[model samples]
Target: MKTVAVIDYGMGNLHSASKALEHVADRNTRVVVTCDPETILQADRVVLPGVGAIRDCMAEIRRRGVDDVVRQVVASERPLLGICVGMQVMLNHSEENGGVECLGLMSGNVKFFGRNLKDAAGNKLKVPHMGWSMVDQHQPHALWQGIEKNARFYFVHSYHAHAVDDEVAVGRCDYGVNFDVALAKGTVFAVQFHPEKSAANGLRLLENFLQWSP
Candidate 1:
């Protein structure tokens, strides 16, 4: 049985993520929603979930002194996943909240959507990029296992990740501009979409993560 640590920094919703994972992976998997560094380090996997500003998330992580625990967990090559704003923390930097530094687990920058940007249909779109959107897989990744082409997932992010190397980009979504919707490198995998809120596709995504080897 694999224990997944659902990192609780008091930044975003926790029950939704835990419940979704529990449903997909079954009761054998334990979901630890906590800010405790010790528990996070001891867990077999980590899932960072958030829905607040980047600065606040970072601050909470630092305040709890779990930043190093996150680094250690990823350094050990164990599984680690980040969702939405949680995914943004995996980048090197973010332009939001007056420019703040991120966890640096992945070499990338997070940027916001343009206000005047239009979709491929030439219609003006909203900034937050809310509601259900399509995620196109750009590369083979366990995080996307069993996922079909043009699968729609729930998203509520205003910013997107720009990986320094496009190879790490496993999925992309278009919103005025094409953004790095998902990222994967070694044991570290993250998505800008909220899998817990993405329905069956999201559950399969979590199931895939549970099935991921190394």
Candidate 2:
């Protein structure tokens, strides 16, 4: 059976991610949420799901040696998905926790939305940018199959992906500012929103991922 390993680095949402993946993944596919490097390395596909401070997330990821495993996964061209802080940690650096260095799997950095964030109309917006927001699929990708053009997804974070390789974003959303929500390079695809917390649209995205070849 094909295996999909969801890395459990303490800062991740293991239960929710595993359940979500299992819900979409076929019976022939095995989903293993583990902290073991070998388990992750052996998997046909991998997911990096996280929630928490970037500083602590990086600390625990390195402490558990999952960072190296992820690098190997990308190097080998296995399909890898990063959710929330998991997506943030794949960047070069993050301004969270005073400042934290990331895995640099992708070319970019995470940034804060600012203390006094306001929408286009200048309405005061919250720091975390919580709740459902529209995600515009500007650049088409396999993971977005069956999902609407500007579908709403659950978001709960103050930081967001700023720029990716200085090119157009695959998915862009406006909270108080325009930021990248979904990114794709090679076989790797990442989203800043929590698809598990999202509804049917979220499930569709996951299903697309399972069927996606690239």
Candidate 3:
């Protein structure tokens, strides 16, 4: 049976994420929400999810030794997915919390949306970038399979990733400014939006992830 471990370091909306995964996982698949390193490392796939401040999230991740587990999983090249703050922490650094160092698994930086921001219409936009936004697919990735090109995904973040290499950026979105919304490198796939809250399109993405080979 395939197993997918949802890493629980005390920061993510574990219930929602696990439920969504469970709903889409095949009948033989088992979805586990756990903090145990052994269980996470042994699972067929790993999901890093968070929905809080980067400082607190990183603190818990490191404190619980999940950081090392994440690194190990990435090294294994097993299918891995990161959501929201989960995605941000994959970068080298973040402007949040004045500034916080991250896992540096990927060469990039997390930046704030800034106070002075305006939309294409010259209208002021809010921080956190709440609500749904179009996710423009940049390249053909397994995660994007079955998902429409420019499908709207739920987003609620104040900071976004800026990958050093654009080649890893598989999805892009625009708030007041364009930013990398989804990144794909090797077996890792991360997104700034909440797939569980994205309705049909979101569920399709999760289902695709479950069936994705790499």
Best by lDDT: 3
Q: Please, what are the lDDT tens digits per residue for candidate 2 over residues 74-173? A: 9989899999999898889999899999998888989999999998898999989899999999798878888888999999998999756645368999
lDDT of 1 by residue, 1-214 (tens): 7689998878867999988888877667787787777888888889988888898889988897768888899888899988888888888999998899998888999997867878788899888888998888988887777889879999888888899988999899877888898899889889899999999999999998887886
RMSD of each: 1.2, 1.1, 0.7
lDDT for 35 in candidate 2 is 86
By lDDT, rank the candidates, best first.
Answer: 3, 2, 1
Model 1 ranges off by over 4 Å: none
Cα lDDT computed for each candidate against the true fold? 0.87, 0.88, 0.92
Q: How far is candidate 3 from the true structure (C-alpha RMSD, Å)?
A: 0.7
Give the clashing residue pairs of candidate 1, or none: none
Worst 10 residues of 2 by lDDT: 162-171
